[model samples]
Target chain A: MKASPMVEIKNLKKWFPMKSGFKSKSNLKAVDGVDLHIYGGETLGLVGESGCGKTTIGRTLIKIYEPTDGEFLYRGGDSSEGGVDIFSLSESKMRPFRREIQMVFQDPYASLNPRITVHDIISEGLRVHSMGKSREERKSMIAGILEKVGLRPEYMYRYPHEFSGGQRQRIGIARSMILNPGLVICDEPVSALDVSVQAQVINLLEDLKHDFGLTYLFIAHDLAVVKHICDRISVMYLGRIVETAETDQLFDNPLHPYTSGLLSSIPVPNPHMRKIGKREIVKGDIPSPVDPPETCRFVKRCPRAFDRCCKESPSLREVSDGHFVSCFLYD
Target chain B: MPKFFYKRKLDEIEEKARPVHINSYRQLVWTKFKSHKLALFGAVVLIGVAFFTLLGPLFVEVGYEDMDFSNLFSPPLTEGHPFGTDELGHDVLVRVMYGGRISLFVGFASAVITTLIGTIVGLLSGFYGGIVDRLLMRFVDVMLSIPMFPILITLTLVFGSGIMNIILVLTVFGWMGVSRLVRGLVLSIRETEYVMSARAMGVRNGRIILRHVLPNVIPIVIVSATLNMSYAILAESSLSYLGLGIQPPMPSWGNMLQRAMNYILGTTTGTNPWWLTVFPGFFIFITVLNVNFLGDGLRDALDPKFVSES
Candidate 1:
């Protein structure tokens, strides 16, 4: 990255307790020992299969869920800044930290409030963090942001119910960007949307990044969508990053068998890369987060597993200058 | 499974012409409700009775408790009194109208207050989901354990009977059930993606609870409040009938019933004079029913949980 690292994840772990009513919970490691660097003005895509803990990683980095163990450092120098190990800070201390980071969620239908007018929905972040000094300032700022997201200023008075799904997702974007956050986690932002609208939103995101100098940890399962937008991509499996490489490098020659399998599975019409007669069909569902294997998690599904793979959980080693992978094959 | 399948098919056929938003829930309910022949008749009868009772007495001169012993029991359609005189010689028509106003007032007032209080408590408890929830829900549980009749009687015995006092008690405990309702609503709504987005935006607790959570709970609250009004009105009348609700001279619907009970019992209560009990009883029934219809229609119109009307 040309720019400095805006956010750093150092051995981050998030374990959710598996419990029922009045029952003691067993620890379930949802995000286990994830280390990553997201630099300023860069989009880092965290791609994974379902339940691979990509979403958990996003939530934990923002302190929505405290890490079980690890350090999350913010770039600010404020009293609430510079990585006091967010898990140790009081909730009030975490308040101002919220202004720096925001999230745009998947499911546009579920992300923008139905009862709220587009105005209140968009202006909410501005009002909460005390961004604008006066009502007119807030209004103009809200209108400006709405227009930035491809919405008419007049539609501010209308409730969310009046808008289409894509429009609502735009409003959701407007709400998050009203504060012009430094870091925004777009969690599967286009999955719920139709294919055509997806391109518009992705383009909007790209334009917004250029305008606002934003950094993103775009989490999604579809590598095809993430391929163009992300500067670097980390492919995860069962709560751990299996491979990390620059987007082009990862796409051109995926080394990890899991990454290779994921890339091979993409139903694209690329003629040259086509393996018409061969498909890497991964066996078995993702292993449960509860009581994960002591060895390499990919061992069970790996077609290339060996004796050493069963005895050791591979460390994320730098295979090339910036490329990292966690596989015995690399060692 | 087949029954559900057939019903689902019928719903699909009905849903075909329906708009995507409305077709899912609101329109389906509305079309089904509209098709119900008896509910429609009940709805009309209810509206007519409420219109005449609630609006009819606004034109009369006599006060609700006005008395003139000389004209007592002069019979129905009598001159100077269309509904004739009661045992107290008061104009029964005027009395029932005013009583209707009072009954509707108490019922509506109690229901509204209850819904508001319940919604606030519910949102806080359900959305917060920790010590706050524990304390607030424990309070609700404590309130719920108290028996309705005994509490009303004790309150009447201790604080004395009047409209405001009765409304206060009704609202106090009336909020319990709807609190549970709204809490359940907020529980579901808080987990919704919109709420998550709001939280991610650094939106404060109060704004999220009010804007995102509260609106989602409106359908449930409206439906519950509408039902609660019927209960409130019935409870008030029952209290008055037991001589503990509105004291003598206020002439509540329940007090009206209490006075007419003797006459009905003495005359087998089936005689044409039965209009006394019948009219007041009919007013209570219709007011409750109309409030229900209003709730139903509002549910169809404003409920967001129901699929958007295509």
Candidate 2:
């Protein structure tokens, strides 16, 4: 991999301040610390259960929520080497980068403005960036993108509510990709659609990814969906990345106990195979992110926890050529 | 999933060949609004009343202030007076028509002023959020706490009785409700993902509020403005009846009502001067009723939930 990565985030943290009058202020550490590197045209899957902070990572990386701590870097082209430190850039200075990095929100219903037409929704980015020469040129560009996203150009005139869930997701994808963004942060884009429509959207995304050389931070809770599209996978526990590796490698041999437990939870089609395969059942609820314990965040629910795991948290370390894990077992 | 792939390939080919059609949110809203029967009726009534008030006086031969002593105390269908004459022999029809102009002007002017101020305050407070929000909301609270009529009375006394002064008083107090209304709406709207998307697009704060937010809030603003008109008209009438708004020789509906009371009490020349009271009271009633109807219709038309339901 001689080509410089598109985005490199090191020890990224986003903490929300909870303070009201007389009560003492405390930070809710959503994305405590995450290190990730995404190559030019690969979909990096970020998997975690609800409230595990996968969404926050995507948002913080996009500068929607300012990074509380750490550095986010973006290398624009092949030879223009040294990556731009996005985390440190002022809002005005960050404008050009925002054009390169766009996001597709989860709920299609909530994401696209109901008051806006599909044409406006898809072309808003172009308008914001002041792209194209005229309205006619923009319309033609939008029409072409609409067709590529599996939506007819005619549908561009319609409002969001007029479209089906699958269609709305296609519109959302078009909106994000209209700028020909280098890196797109897909925040559970298909999670709100019906099960039947999910596969169509997923295929559309995959086709779009191949058609245009686009990188993505695909965040979702379902490992099954992530496996189909993501080349590399990063599993999150609480507010930290516990394990990361190539998709096939992560699936076959999960390094962290938390990752293994997550893999086991995915149901097998054959009942006989299900019984034969050992399922890891760990107990206890996920601890509160606000004032998290000093030990490993997943230690309470980890079946393989020991005395060392209870006292000191393990930072992520490269256990193999490409695989990284954050646990005492890896140490 | 495999079945979806096989089925969708054929649909995609056919779908792509289709021509584009133009549509817009404005068109959709207009279509939705047009379907509401009562809203259409209200619009018609409003237009009719406004037309009559604005231009009806041009066709009438009698002057509002022309006092014909020979026609004093004359009933309806008199030689020259069709609607009849008041105790002062003024044409009741002409006076009501003239009063409508003043009354409608005061209502609309005050409502427009109030809506503008309220919207600006709400946008500033709600979009900026922190201390600006607190300060503006507290001001609204303080404004709301003042007894409107009594303060208006005291202020009118200090300022002297005039049309502009009454409008100013109404506008000062009227804006609080609308500001609170707009602030509450903006608070919820600001949290929505569309607004977030706009921010992520690097749209300036002012542009976001104007383009993304203001359109969403316009329907509600319009509804409040229409309702505010009724409040303004009623307030002006009350002030005028109290001998404060649109003073003597000006012929406001409120001052007309004040003079009508004299006829009602048998203190004036006429034994029965019902036209003096009836026409002014009727015009006020009609104007307020139509405005309320328009407000109700606008509320239904503007409501997204209502549009979906229908």
Candidate 3:
């Protein structure tokens, strides 16, 4: 791993204000004070239940949804000194970085435009950036990228409707990869695919990451899928990250109760082994993010919650050589 | 027989193995449109009518105003009077052709103006979507709430009916529907993932609206414009029928119909000259009906969900 992080998010916050009454207002804190570092050439998996702000983190990083507060430091090539604070830059100033950070959307059907052909969809970024000199040159470039993404070059002329879900996803991957981005945010890329087709898309992503020397922030609810592709994994609850560690270390010795509960919920294939394995199912629905109490978010759901867990929120702290946890039990 | 069958089977396999031919967006729409038999028939009839009105006047010797005292009120199939003559000895054939030119021009010009205003308003209103949306929508509501026919009549009366003034009145009353349709479409399309993806690529707002958002709204605009053309033609006819549209000396399908009413009631020559009334009314009916069919075909063909079988 590189000595310095490629992207560092510090105290990131994204709150959506709601109109509770004519005069009264409340906020839904989708991502509240999230701090993360994504090193170059490593896949960092972000796993959480639905509406835990995993997708919000990814979107804010790409500036799709502007951060309410915080510094998003991005260290490009040769910028070892302090990096550029992406959140502070204006949109025009952020143009070059948009080419460097691309995203693979969750829904393949919705991501690709139906009116245009695959050639137009893939070449859109290139045209915006003025990467190719001529139309013919851009066509050849698109054809080449299509081949790289495991799609036939001839499919470039076809409309998006002609393709299956898996094929459309491959096209989405091609769209992001054509720019040769440094960080590719995969937001539930395979969650919408059939079980039989999920592994195929995951393998394609893994293969492309290796080929391009790309880093990824893989956001998914499936731990099994993330386990196969991620080097490190971060578990989040509500708007805060509860734990993060090396993939093997985090799986072997789960620090947070939430992490342990998540691992236990993954159904074992062996019928006999299921009886031996202990289940630690966390109780109750995830609390509403709107006007949440200023205490640990997991207190109500945590089976191991005690007095200290309710009185105050726990900040993420390094507990071992590399593993970090935010639970009061770790303290 | 076995050898011949074997050879044919091999050829069939080769044919099946060939690659699928890719069609562009335009080609797909064209193919889908071509398959609708009524639309195709309508398109052909419309094209013929347009050409006749536009070019037939150049070839005809008699002008619409030319009056023949000896041939006044002559019936059809008479010498040099295939469509016969009106009460004033004006050739009905020449007048109908000349009226077509005015009616078709008004329809097309008014449709173009309405589409332009509607699309711009809708794009700006939907894309910006805060104060702009509220203000524009309220204005559209105000415009829509006003009874259109009465306002059109009042405006035509005030403006003093000429071709330009009638078109201006029609355009003012006509654009609200298209603007409302386009605004509704744009509101949904603005939230679509493809549009978000385009914005994330750092494409400028203007470029995104034009390239990504506008293309999706185009099908609705096309359908609306076609409907508007028919509406404009009908409105002009009605206005002219009441003596508040394209004044006499200038032939329009509307005034010609009005002129034929005299012969129908036998107020002028005591003879019901069916040719005068039939020709002008027929042209108006044919043009409006065919234009509507073309619009219906376009709506189906341009739908993204529409799957062309082959």
Candidate 4:
């Protein structure tokens, strides 16, 4: 938690030009004007509704999709200028960046390649980056990484089909961590898992982070899960970060109206604690990202939206130390 | 001590272990495949015969080159002779094995080359979809519609004979049907959440196709490929029969049968041997049937869709 920042994004925007109708071309903004910092040894829990650009932000940070506009800074980890603007470099220069900042994808079932043996899947990153020297050395290193991920070494020869969902996730985690990357974007790492298995994975990730001194950009829609692991949290609304703060601060005293509503809506265990439900309910469905609103992306459904909120798009700004919010009410 | 040793070994193995299934599809399909004794036997026998036929001639000193006129038409299993001698008195069984070399090579090699080309192109075209899919499929359809034989004939007529030429034609034109089959495979496998998960993992498009989509289609390609080789052998035989395939002195079964047809009729009618046509035809039937049987076994073993209700 005391370590310096490892990754930085400045006004990153990712727009997809998807032409759906037989007649017209439509442009959709999947991740627009989002900026956040991930410090080494810290987990940045990015929570939001489905289709709220959580995945997009994670991807943009990883350089899978080129940010349509903005600068991505990577420092002191995987060789991209030790805090260099990642988006500025060509793909040839991005190789080490990819190796250093790996991704533990959301779906364990799909993240690993089914055709390849678990050994090969784990070693593929090593091969591409020329990490380990000999085949035997790579095998040993892969075995070691697999063990670190709580999988037995012999699983190296087995195909992806041989593993259960939890084991498959461990394989995915192993594949990402095989390179011993400093930053791993765990995109909803345990969302696809059974409820009982989620805690085990969370524990495993915590152990791995402590052991390896790894940083995680943990993305999820479940507020409770994110609260469990994330030191700092960010809530997104339609491709924009609505609010960001430390976990305790956000839950204890939510500044953004949306954050407060999300917390109040979480099912409390005690039925006796029930006051008349003054919990703010989000009305209306998520609007299509295509040709989104020019002003506040969530103004139509925001409880505190005013005349100014409708006319102007709020920029992400520091409302307090280590806390940021993008809303005219905060302004 | 042994048990402890084994337990430690098992524990170490388990640490680097795969999640094992207590009950699996193994007992089912594996038994089914083995039960296909004819197919299983065919695979083993054909593999053995093919190994000898293909690799045997390379090692042997005297080939179809050595001619013995006095030994010509010697009845099979004669003194110090087996399967008799031909008109030139060349060793018949040796020539037959050598002939199998050429026939099996042209068949299997062409089929493999064709199937690889088809599956790769089809997987990319179908999985990506849109204008690419339309164009590629249409091209495949056009290639399929054209009479494969005439085109092959024209190609052979232009390119001439030998194993290389035959493999070239088969690879170039033989991919059409396989491409269609692979396109269907890709179309379905692409829908699996696993593939989408790969894309989400930041895996590149090429890597996703090769790693995620291609392996599932391998069983289909493997089965279809063996069958295609059988067809390829027949095509080559027909070419040889028409005097367009492997030129004489190369010792193809088709040319041998062609040369022996007159003698076979003569043996039935007059004094020449009737075994000529019978021998070549027998070899051809056996080779095709064996390859088909192997393919059937593979299909039964690998295809999840073909799981027999036990």
Give each prediction's DockQ, rounded to 2 decimals. 0.23, 0.29, 0.24, 0.15
* B36-153 per-residue lDDT for model 2 (tens digits): 7666777787788778877888998767778988888788889878778877788877887788889989998999999999998998888888999999888888998988778877
lDDT of 4 by residue, A177-272 (tens): 777677888989999999988999999999888887888899998888999999999888888888889999999878877787788889988888
Looking at model 3, residue A82 earns an lDDT score of 85
lDDT of each: 0.79, 0.82, 0.86, 0.77
Candidate 3 chain A weakest lDDT stretch, 10 residues:
A135-144
Best by DockQ: 2
Instruction: Give TM-scores for every candidate, taking all chains together and pairing residue i with residue i.
Output: 0.84, 0.90, 0.89, 0.73
Candidate 2 chain B weakest ten by summed lDDT: B1-10
Off by over 4 Å in 4: A1-4, A77-82, A130-143, A303-309, B1-39, B45-106, B119-168, B180-217, B233-289, B296-310
> Which regions of candidate 3 deviate over 4 angstroms?
A21-23, A275-277, A307-310, B1-36, B58-62, B66-91, B145-159, B258-278, B296-310
CA displacement after TM-score superposition, residue B27 of candidate 4 (Å): 18
lDDT of candidate 3 over B1-310, digit per residue (tens): 0010111232233244334435556766888899877788889999999998989889889998889889988998789988998878888888888999999999999999999999999999998898999999899889878886687677766876788988888887778778878888889988887887888788888988887889899888987898889888878878887777888877888888887776686645567788888898899889889987888788778865676565
Clashing pairs in 1: A110-B194, B19-B310, B20-B310, B21-B308, B21-B309, B22-B308, B22-B309, B22-B310
Per-prediction interface RMSD in Å:
17.6, 8.5, 14.2, 9.4
lDDT of 1 by residue, B29-133 (tens): 666556555446656876676686678876877876787677777677888888778777788888888787788788879988998898888888899998999
Candidate 2 Cα errors over 4 Å, as ranges: A2-4, B1-37, B68-79, B146-154, B258-277, B292-310
Local accuracy of candidate 4 as per-residue lDDT tens digits, B1-310? 0000111243455453435422235654576688778778987878887786777777656676577666767777775446666667776666777788788788878988898889888897878888999999899888878886788777777887677987787787789889889999899888664664454334577887887788788888888888888888877877777766887788777677777765764543355664555666678888888888888787777543454454
